[model samples]
Target chain A: MAVYHADALVIRSREYGESDRVLTLFSREMGKIQAVAKGVRKPKSRQRAGAQLFTYGDFLIHKGKSLDTVSQCSPKESFSYLWSDLDRSLAASAMAELLDISTISGQPNAELFTLTLTCLFLLEQYETSLLLSAYALRLMVILGYRPHLGDCVECGERLQGERLFFSSEAGGTLCGRCRESYSGRMVRAGSIAFMRQLIQADLSKLDRLRWAAWMREEVLETLRHYLEHKFERPLKSWRLGNTISDGLERHIRSLNGKEGKEFE
Target chain B: MDFLNYPQPLADLISSLARLPGIGPKTAGRLAFYLLQQPQISQDLAQAILTANHSLKKCSICSNFTDQDPCALCQNPQRDSTELCVVEHPRDVVSLEKTKEFKGRYHVLHGVLSPMEGIGPEQLTINLLLKRLKGVQEVVMALNPTVEGEATALYLARLLKPLGIKVTRIAHGLPVGGDLEYADEVTIARALEGRRQL
Candidate 1:
């Protein structure tokens, strides 16, 4: 059996046969690889921590006939905060979902690797929606789908307006003349600028930027359409995140007994 | 040529059994041969599978698989109407009931929120649980200790807490007879988080 070790991130994990887990691990050295972590679901299994979702670890793998086997592993970071909260965990889940759908096995992008690690760590301290939107925007940039933001994707003219037209199909902001060429949404200038800043910002210093509720939501929706256009399929986690947030909002209002005064 | 070269009917049986969760082709062949050797065993197993599949329906109140609408547990007057225990599956309800400690009725979500698996709140019975929460003071979440399970529990807590209902989760910790030295940090942290003054 060929044995090798890599510092890996558990981007996705699913239950396999009894007490076993199949892991989609992302390592700077190996890119993405699928391996079976035998018996990780068992209480005594030492690999349990490293096999968890969003965990960063050093893994020793034994290459087998079909699926690689995880021989040994020790967690470097569990991103444990992601597990304790609902929204943050779902945000991390979205990151994993994007990576899983966007990347292929055996081709490693080191910059994307660093971005994923930095973003997941920052997610522990920051607001989930803004951080996740920024991560998604930056992720697309790193993946070479850098949206043309300075000017119209079609006409190549710098757009200056209170509200700008953005098209996922056109791959960026479109001028008033080019807007009619593509069907897209009318978005605030601040939202487009926020996305541009997110794409250009350093990953390590991402939290330095404040979370603007209006800007992030708009950017996220636009990016959602952009990603679906690029990937040709909507991500499950992205949709689930919206559903959860909407449910929570309704729940919060009910708890506060926020109702009209007709009853009073 | 295929090994064993079984007859068409035998091959079909072997292929069907191999499609089960854990059984492999070799195990399926072994089982098929064993079944053929014992006629009564094959008949009894087929009858059980058909009966279970044909008769079982989700209970109206809890969503647990039962032959009757309200299920025996829902019909029982001993169960606390003021409290409800929510779980991911009917098997989980059975496991909790075996303890005989929880006096409340159960609402099975049928699944936890697992986005990667394409499972969400819509795929679960969360709406049913929400509608049934009237007159219930507390909803105790007895979900599994997995990531999806914890997330589902947290989501439900947030959803139910707004209705003036006290929502709580079953304590997640080291298993019985599990050594402290072998326990993972997540387990240890949760155990400490849920620690009580004794």
Candidate 2:
């Protein structure tokens, strides 16, 4: 077995049996690696902290016939803060989900790993959920799933002052005239602009953008639409998030005793 | 399968570990071998696992991971009981607590409503939440800004509107540090439309 070392992100993991685990890792040097961590589930395993989901670490793996074996794992970035809050954790999950979908297994794309690490770090430092949303949208773009946010994708004209439509099929924005020819959903002009900024802005600039509450919702919705259009399957975490939000709203209404005001 | 000199217990352990999230067969085998070299490590791991398994419980009010039923946040007198932020999981409550932007209570649904997955209202903590709404004044739908999140928010809005308490959704659109010029028109428009009066 050939042994190698690399910086890796724990993309996902599944239990094999009693004491072993199969890990799907995205590494800076090797892209995506499928490895087995033997006996890490056992008590006092040294690799326990380094092998957790969302853990960034230096990993030692020995090449096996079918898969790689994780011999040594030293934690580089634990990102414990991301799990400290619900919004941050979900934001992190959304990013991880996007990375999981965008790249093919076993393909080594260092850029993607760096992007994932950068985004995770940003989520840790910033309290704003909008930053995380923007980062996820941009990850899709970096991986060639970039949605059309600028002028009409159909006509290739400037979309200024026009009611813009987002055709996930068309792969960009559509002007009013071109929008008629496309069958995709219409995205408000504001949403299109917001997405464009997310795609083009640098991390430093993204940190400075002052966001309002409604604007955050629009950005998240736009990204969700694009991701759904790309991945076909809705994210599991997103669904859970919605149910809880709904139930809470209903509970609050019942407590207030007004029971007739518009909730949406 | 080559069975000569193979330990059944070791092979079984490797296969089982391979099924875990990030572990593969090779890593599983290595870990198993490592465990064989250190029985003390295995013993400590077993104890910790048992302790965590037995000690961790959901807080009755917020549904967060805790040793106590009400949890610290639910029991805290300083928290605003009238204003509640509804989130998808316990992690969100932890995030909001750090912000200091909110001092209200929280309710975790544990999961969301997805019709395709056969998850409905009854599958969540909707009943418990409804029971807790006796004197709350506001409910903030703080779910992720995703399609499902929006659908859930809308669903809650519809349900809560009829009951007459103020229901607000966490806003969506652009990031605080994003560029105006790069922003798509749809986002800009939504930001404008959803703009609040300062």
Candidate 3:
């Protein structure tokens, strides 16, 4: 078994056997690979933090007969903020999930790997929804699944600032005429432009984009439909975020019940 | 190959033991061979497993496994009901009870919010916890500091906040007696942020 080193991100981590973790890593050198981190679940294991989900690390691995074993791992950036903040954690999980489900093993895509690390790192600083949407759109572009947002896919109709629809089936924006034949979820023209910019713009320019609540909800749903439709699998991580946030909203509604009440 | 393997009956026993968490085929084989060699030990162990499985049921109030319906903690009048400590597992309830500092009763969640593992809120005992929180002044979250555990605590906090209950999480920081140099950044940061004034 040959020993190798890779700068990797721990995307998916789960308990395996006794005191071991099976990690699906996205590395610059190895692409997406599954490795077993031995005894990391032990109380005193040094690799516990490094093996956690969304941790970016330098890993020394030994190629095994079946699975690769992580002989040594040191977390360069654990993204601890992402772990503590529920909203950010959910967003990061969705990104990780996208990378895991879409990509195959041992085929390196430096773009996707770098995008994932950037998104995870910026998840602490940026609006989580925007970061998630941007990452998803960028991921699609990188994987050659970029949606047609500039013009109608059915007909080469230039999308004007009017009644527009996004059809995941058609793989892009649909005009009013196209929508009559094929149904697409009604979305604003601005959201289409926003998504276009999100996909095309560099990662550094992400902070400049103005994100609204309406944009977040609409783009999130639209991309979710498109991504799920393309992958033919449900976005479990995205659903997890939505449902948990709904719980938070339920709490807010309860707090709003005390109208005109004195502050505690 | 057949001769190299254990006999059918022994193989069956080993396989059964291997299905258990943390027990591999090798350990299971050792355990099975030991059981077969000692008839008294095997009989006693089997009886103990069956008895524990048959008798111990989840407590009606807290959902912790117990021989009684309400469990000793829930039934104990000396324990305070106003302060409720919510934990992810029955083992967590045991750990907290060991401290003896907390006189309040506990509510076991059975598990955390792990979506990657296909666990949703529906898979947990959240509804039961909400229903049983009448007159409870505070809900203390004693969950792990992992991503799933944090999300579970946040979800529960939001779901329970509508009831006008005060919800707080347990302090998670650098472990006592552990070297500062060896502590992970997450733990150290959390400790710094949560530092108390002397």
> Global CA lDDT of candidate 3, please?
0.84
Please give, for residues B1-198, the per-residue lDDT of candidate 3 as tens digits. Answer: 232387888888988888898787788888988999999999999999999999999997889999999899999999899999999889888889888889998999899887666677777887668667667889999987777888888778766676688999999776667778877665677789889999
Q: Identify the candidate with maximal lDDT.
A: 1
Native contacts retained by candidate 1: 0.47
Where is the poorest 10-residue window by lDDT in model 3 chain A?
Answer: A255-264
Q: Return the clash pairs for model 1, or none.
A: none
Model 1 over residues A122-163: C-alpha lDDT tens digits? Answer: 898887877888888888988989988758898799889789
lDDT of 1 by residue, B117-162 (tens): 7788778887677666667889998886777888998898777665
Clashing pairs in 3: none
A1-264, model 2: which lDDT tens digit per residue? 399997899877655656677888899888888899988655345565566667888899999998889999877777756433445655566667667766777688877787789878888667546666777776777777777677667667877764567776677777778777666765567766777787788875677766667767767766676677778878655554555456555565555554323222
Q: Could you list the iRMS of every candidate?
A: 3.8, 13.8, 4.2
**RMSD of each candidate?**
3.2, 14.3, 3.8
Q: In model 2 chain B, which range of ten residues has the least summed lDDT? A: B144-153
Off by over 4 Å in 1: A176-183, A208-212, A249-264, B1-11
Give the best candidate by DockQ: 1
Candidate 2 accuracy as TM-score? 0.57
- Best-to-worst lDDT order: 1, 3, 2
Off by over 4 Å in 2: A247-264, B1-198
Q: What is the TM-score of chain A in candidate 1?
A: 0.91
